[model samples]
Target: MFKILDKQELAESIIEYTIEARDIARHHHAGQFCIIRVHSHCERIPLSIAETNSQAGTITLVVQIAGHSTQELAQLEAGDSILDVVGPLGQPTKIGSPRRGIFVGGGVGVPAGSSMVRQMKQAGAQVLAIIGFRSKDLIIYEEKMRAVADELVVTTDDGSYGYHGLVTEPLQERLAAGEKYDVVITVGPVVMMRAVAEVTRPYGTHTIASLNPIMVDGTGMCGACRVTVGGETKFACVDGPEFDAHQVDFAELAQRLEIYRDEELRAHEAGPHECRLEQALKELG
Candidate 1:
């Protein structure tokens, strides 16, 4: 059991947990993720490693309470133990001395991009970050991203803060203004990453995307996280959670993610049984 050393609410329905996993924390690099099981009966879920401290023997995971498993995980507090925490899985991002690089993130993807930006800066690259959210209340990791990036642009769809537009807007404008980038990295919803790829493709910029598909086992045995890249089959679990943006078949991946929608809805509707049943029994009494 891995103990929850710390927990912080980053935003509404979004929380960050620091877990005691010394071995994984010590070896994890940027762009790798961990598979966690809230309990023995719960399905395993994959989450990006937001930050790590080897000395502290902890790794930070930022989670959005999207479905049943994540909502249950969020209920855990400091000192609570997680049943299974398997990790340092998938290929780490390849950091090199690119002259200039752009990192783009949306919603919860911001935390996933944070460590990557730091690694890029450490490798002597001029990193620029563009992050998007629905509104000000949904934004997270702004200061963290700003600290590592040479330049940071925050955008909101509702005009609540920073620039009032999608993250792709500034990126498109920058490329239109003749700004050059050696590489572009993005992490977000499938549609958002697709948009980023479209924007960067014409400029001949190399783009990398961190994909979050429906994954069962963190290892390659399950075949649940299979995706098509360059017209070939690849498993996101072992081969990558990261891939070339140009080669990913986004439409197929998007469809596959919805395969469990009905089951997910049923789980959410059921909610936490103990709380639900206890409240109902009290009201009846």
Candidate 2:
């Protein structure tokens, strides 16, 4: 059983949990994720490892209560025990000798990118991070990203905060300014990552996007997370939650996110135990 050590409300419906998972945190690294199960009957869900401290034996998970499992997970308070917590799964980000790097994170991707930014900075890379949201009320972790990154740009579609546009704006400006980045990592909404790929295409920048598809199992066997990268199929779980953004098929990914659309909606309306983010947002409304 994983013990909940702390809980925080980041946004209206978003909750961050710090769990005492000694074994999991001890082996966790930046960019790794975990598959959480609320109980024996709960559906498996993948969540990013927002932060971890091996010495403290804790792992932090920032989750927007979107579905059933996540909604249930949110109601859990400190000292509550989770039925199962299975990870530090998938490969960790490779921040080799960080040249100049740009980290782009949108919405929930903000927290995930926060850890990666800190990790890359700790490795001696000058980090420039961009975080975006629909509006000011939805934004999170800008200051956290700024603390580690050398430069941080915040954007919102409605001009509610920071720049009034997508994260791609400043990214292009950097490119125009003759910045040569060793890597461009983006994690966010499907459309946002796709847009990132489009803008960086001509520049030949290596853009890595953290792929969040319909993953049944956090292993290669399920083949549920399979995606075409450079015309070849790869699983987002075992192969990557991160991939070459340039070669990724964003159209196919968008379709996959809708594959279970009806069922997901049905599940959402059924109860808070259906999906984490959606359910929580509904409850907030």
Q: How high is the lDDT of residue 38 in model 2?
A: 74
TM-scores of the candidates in the order shown: 0.94, 0.92
**Best model per TM-score:** 1
lDDT tens string, model 2, 36-143? Answer: 887666667788988888999999888888765667677789889888888888888876776788999999888999888887787888999999998999988877
Candidate 1 on 1-285: residue-level lDDT in tens? Answer: 999999999999999999999999999999999999888777677999999999999999999998877888988999999999999999999856888999999988999898999888888889999999999999999999998899999999999999999999999999999999998999999999999999999999999999998777779986778999999999999999999999999999998777555557766788654333223323434
Model 1: pairs clashing at backbone N, Cα or C within 3 Å: none
Question: Which is the leading candidate under lDDT?
Answer: 1
Q: RMSD of each candidate?
A: 6.1, 4.8
lDDT of each: 0.90, 0.83
The parts of candidate 2 lying over 4 Å away from their true place are 270-285
Runs in model 1 with CA error above 4 Å? 270-285
